[model samples]
Target: MTETAPATATPGTPTDPGTGSIAGPSVAYQNWIDRQSRNRRQVQVGRALILIAFLALWEVAPRAGLVNPMLTSYPSAVWEGFLELLAQGNLGLHIGVTLLEVMISFAVAMILGTVVAICLWLSPMLEKILDPFLVVGNALPKIALVPIFYIWLGPQGSIYAVAIAVALFITILMLYTGFSQTDPNKIKLARTLGAGKRQILTKVVLPGNVHTFMATLKANVGLSLVGVIVGEFQASKAGLGYLIVYGSQIFRMDMVMAAIVILSLMSVAIYLAVQKAETWLIR
Candidate 1:
């Protein structure tokens, strides 16, 4: 009868004493996870500290007469202006109006642009015919057309028109490019399997371009907001943009700062929402 030797741990390979099971890799993995967690917490702390330092400097600079308070209101004054607006009960209304306009423009641009991109992709002749016109239109300074939109569509309609104009062209261009770039080998395989163009598009192309769609959505958020603000600057009676122009005209720098702060926060929230949606889609 032959005797069996007991399994032993080697260098870099720890073993459970009783069962002789390998445990080193699991411990190393746990250590890596801990390090990653620490790194993320440190990054978050660093960001908070930087923001605090900036706010402190801003608050101190004007008080010390390093800069004119009238021209550059501090954080406290902006907060006060925000409170005053809230008390006036119009702050909510302005925010709501701006948000509604942004959402409408975003939805319209995304839907219309995606359909246009698909149609262009489906017909190479149509794409070729429209290519030069699309390029020219996209290159045209959209800001130059603001007054024309206002004249043609009036105040509310002009807001939507301007917002869509800002976002639609880029969306179509990006989606068409992404669709055209779908792996040729995959398309060839689909065709060889007797798939029609529509099936190839729905099964292979659309699913593959989800990340592109998310990218377009993110870009459209900022562009649509910019267009709405620019339109409101010219044609709006009420909105954050209107408030900004009104405040500047009245030389109420604090009020202007407050509106700008709100706009920044709003944009951040919308961008974060889009990021979260992307994460969900990828999962």
Candidate 2:
């Protein structure tokens, strides 16, 4: 007898028997995936084009005498200024110092802020008592309090205090709001199943607020950087903020612009790190 082929398993999708081709949901889903991929690529290409155009204009405008290079330094001058700092070893030292302070303050702010938020969630009375203070702390111009922190913690240590100050209240308010806004029906359901307060929080409230936690962390990361820079402005002698202040004072516009560019890069890097962590946590 002629050999017969073994039967192959067919996928669940409806198939065109004549062509042996998927002709149902699988085809639609594949098309949707392809469409999304094309859209993402287009977005990336558009963003790159816009950025290149902006940088090209910025670099050209100053050198062509269109914009005052002295007041607004060109990209080449900013690059040269970076090289100057690099040759002097100031670039890495100052960056490391600022990074250290930012990391420390960020950790402290997130921890303490989250704990306080949890406490407020657990006790409505405590939340009401502290609500005004939280709002006031968030609203008050943080720079004005730098002096008090400086005096209390001295010049070098003040950066940590200021960093914590800038991030703490905002984190607390955002997280507490997230916690309070957690679906009450879930909490009630958990309790009806004999879950205790702590169980409800762990199982219902905390899990429900992961996105909020990530959002608040993103906000605090920037705030912590701002605080560190401000603290450097008021106290530190060798950080990027100090460099900016010193450069501006002596009219070394290139150095000031370089410092600013470096700060922007640092903030972007930190924010990217947060985004990466968010993606991992979400996964």
Candidate 3:
């Protein structure tokens, strides 16, 4: 029998079925990628369909005389109003003022709320003593306080008042719950490792409750905007809320709708930013 040439296999060398080259990606991985692409496309299609349907109805109802265009402006009118505002630069000024108020109030509320939460967390007695006060404060309608804030802090006083009203209860309840629910085993472990109360709180409690804090922050963003707008409604010469009041008083529904759209966009942006920050912090 003729001796067959011995098949030689190189050591530490991967062999391919045909070209002897390593594969790029597995079939499973490619399938997963395809699935993700498909899902994203589906989502895009759904959003486009919804937007088209809404615009179609918005345009048709008014044009068909089913709805009075003078009283309720269509999407095109709102778009035109937005373009006019952009040309005049007044829109930018209003947006800036509203943003400033929201940011300042939110910052103050965050700092004060965090400090109070920490204090309450550190002392069970203080939390218990303050619980009733917190309950009552949260229960009270914050809008009713706009006038009081205007009187106390002047017309602009609503900024601080609204921030406090919106954020106080959220921060307190979230942080208190987080503190109370601290993992006992982790606390014990830290103590065993010679960690002091301060160390435990700074290292363990704070980190552990980060998710809760983020959740509270997300909720407070909308609340903060509401407070600012409501405050503006009560007393303000500038801001989107002022724009709405001005537009309504003049029967410029287009302007009112435009301001509303701006408010909605701003709120969404703030919320999305908070979410991104939370994700980054957690990661």
Candidate 4:
């Protein structure tokens, strides 16, 4: 008799005819994972190349004396400056102050803006009345108002004012857009089902516009940071902006560059955090 292969089976398990084992992933699945890994690696390589190019230029121009080292400094000098700031703990303090301003302003703006948007959404008459005011506020140069804020609320007041200025218009615009763009068919369907206005807003409109709200939040993160930095430029005793001004005033180009780098890094960090939160919220 010819030898016969015994069919192997596991209780509660199925086998693939080609692989003989159920534990292995299909080729399509493996290909998808490989493609994703390759894409991730490419992104990483691209980021690394950009950073290396920036640093290389910073190192080359100064060392080659093509630029005035005192005026522009070198990448090494800025790195050393960063180390000094880290050792002294001033960097942390400065960053903390700016973060506090951003958080407070953002929170206040979001709450107030949402309330206003909701009220307007509920009452067309109120929206009509407030439209001009909103338009004028949005048109005004918020930076110019910093001086008035300093005078009225004192120097620290600029911090709150700037944050509000940055966040308010964006929040209002986004929320209004979200509320206005809600699907009319959904509204009609909800009404036909005997849903109240409040129910329509709470159960239908709000959820429908969650994605838009998340996008606005991401945009607000950048705006809030800009507001904080602008406030620092106007009147803060300490912040990344203050550090830049101080360094430049003293002709410490390396310190100025370091502070600029810190500000850029902070912005990136805030942006990334917002993006992560948006992803979670949307999912």
Candidate 5:
């Protein structure tokens, strides 16, 4: 037997050496990738254009007397507020605190969610018993629990707990939904081949839920941030949420807007990290 040298072909088009016909690379996949790339670039450009237009309108509106700067701050005022924060040297400290809380919450929620999901998947009876409780828990207004958490965990840790609570239900729901919806046919096929529960879970169910986990992470990222901000709003002395609260009290709309912009950027950063992870995973 001889191993033939590997054949080289253009992306999307491949040739089989033995049959001298086209084969290997998938044309549809290549085209889809091309289209997706173009769409992504277009979306980014559109977002930039919209942002520019908004800032321009904001700047002109206040200066042209169409709107009040004190009520709706312009980009320049926001920038000035940011600079003041930077000069005060607590800007990074506050951001770092918030990011830390969000990351911790996101991590804890993801781990616990995945574990709980797997446990539920392993026991149908247990899942049935707890499904109602889960539905009720998920349905509960999380923000309403902030005061309870503050009293329970104290100011130092309540923020973290609040963040976790905000995201935990979503994570569990997404993961459990993924695990439950895995094709029954696939499980049965594996079982018919003498595969046990553990084997089926590892080889069939788990592998198929990668995308679900990625989606859950993306959602968890946003939820975690919201939780953190809410926690900070009522708990933390140092964070963007605290800054917004403080600014609002002082009637410094510019500072409040700056803090909000930072929060938005943080959310985007975490979500983009999830997207990057997904890209690496799919590749």
Candidate 6:
């Protein structure tokens, strides 16, 4: 009887018929994927444990006399204050006002910064003329401008003004720097193809610096929030910042902590929103 030779497997065909996986690479790849997933789970667990430990320590320290309860209000007191604020129907208003101011400031700064950066990129002479002034503006103490803005724009207007002022200059600087750093070779290639400045900017410069824009947005979000809070500390009638200031003045440590916790959560939400936007833009 003639013996038939075993059929040879083609490229990408499973070498081991029982396992149905590519020979060497399949095992290695699966191992890598498993390791990565395990690592991620471990990291998440570690973070959760750290947070729990911190909360437990915070809850224990004051009650155990390691820290003063009045000065460093515990988690329970802060939670009660938060619940009370929520029940009073003012928390929502404060959150809404602060969110509105922050969004307005963030939008205005981003729009203005983009416009200014584009103009600067278009005109080297204009950029040179404005460079010193830009530097001075960035270096100037923003806190010093708070009272001036209050005088010029009144209380509510000053909040927007301060928030914009805080984010705008830095946004301009970061964006302009990113714009200027576009590869000269790419620009020359575009020029060789008879592409105009506008085309080059839209097609090459902007696309190349998407990550830079994301970074700028991340920073601007925080700066805008800070500006709003600073303005509220001095001028506004209601906001988490006003809450903090009022609570501190009244020695309501629980209220102050509650406001701070809310602010922290707001910051996280804004940052995550920006990150989600970046992901969408990238895709």
Off by over 4 Å in 4: 1-25
The positional error of residue 36 in candidate 4, measured at the CA in angstroms, is 2.1
Ranking by TM-score: 6, 1, 2, 3, 4, 5
Stretches of candidate 3 exceeding 4 Å from the true structure:
1-24
lDDT per residue (tens digit) for residues 35-90 in model 2: 77887999999999998998899899988999988888878888899899999976
Ranking of all predicted structures according to lDDT, beginning with the best and ending with the worst = 6, 1, 2, 5, 3, 4
lDDT of 4 by residue, 1-283 (tens): 5333333334546777888767555556667667778879999999999999989998999899898899889889999999988998789988888888887887888888888888889888999999999988888888988888888888888788887887898798789889998999999999999999899999998899988877777777778878888888889899888898889889999889998887788778877987888788778
Minimum summed lDDT over a 10-residue window in model 5 is located at 1-10
**Residue 25 Cα positional deviation in candidate 6, in Å, after optimal superposition:** 7.3
Error of 5 at 117 (Å): 0.9
Q: Residue 111, candidate 6: how far off, in angstroms?
A: 0.5
lDDT digits (tens) for residues 1-283 of candidate 3: 5333333434544658799675455566667667778879999999999989998998899989999998889999999999988998888899999998888877777777888888888888998999999888878898888878888888877666876687777777777788879999999999999999889899999899898888888878888888888988879999999999999999999999999999999999999999999989988
Report the Cα RMSD per candidate: 7.3, 7.3, 8.5, 7.4, 6.3, 7.3
TM-score, prediction 1: 0.90
Q: Which ten residues in a row have the lowest lDDT in candidate 3?
A: 1-10
Error of 4 at 138 (Å): 1.9
Model 2, clash count?
0
- TM-score of every prediction relative to native: 0.90, 0.90, 0.88, 0.87, 0.86, 0.91
Assess the local accuracy of residue 16 in candidate 2 as a C-alpha lDDT between 0 and 100. 86
Model 6, residue 206: distance off in Å is 1.0
On the 0 to 100 scale, the lDDT of residue 103 in model 1 is 93
lDDT of the structure predicted as candidate 4: 0.85
User: How good is model 4 by TM-score?
Assistant: 0.87
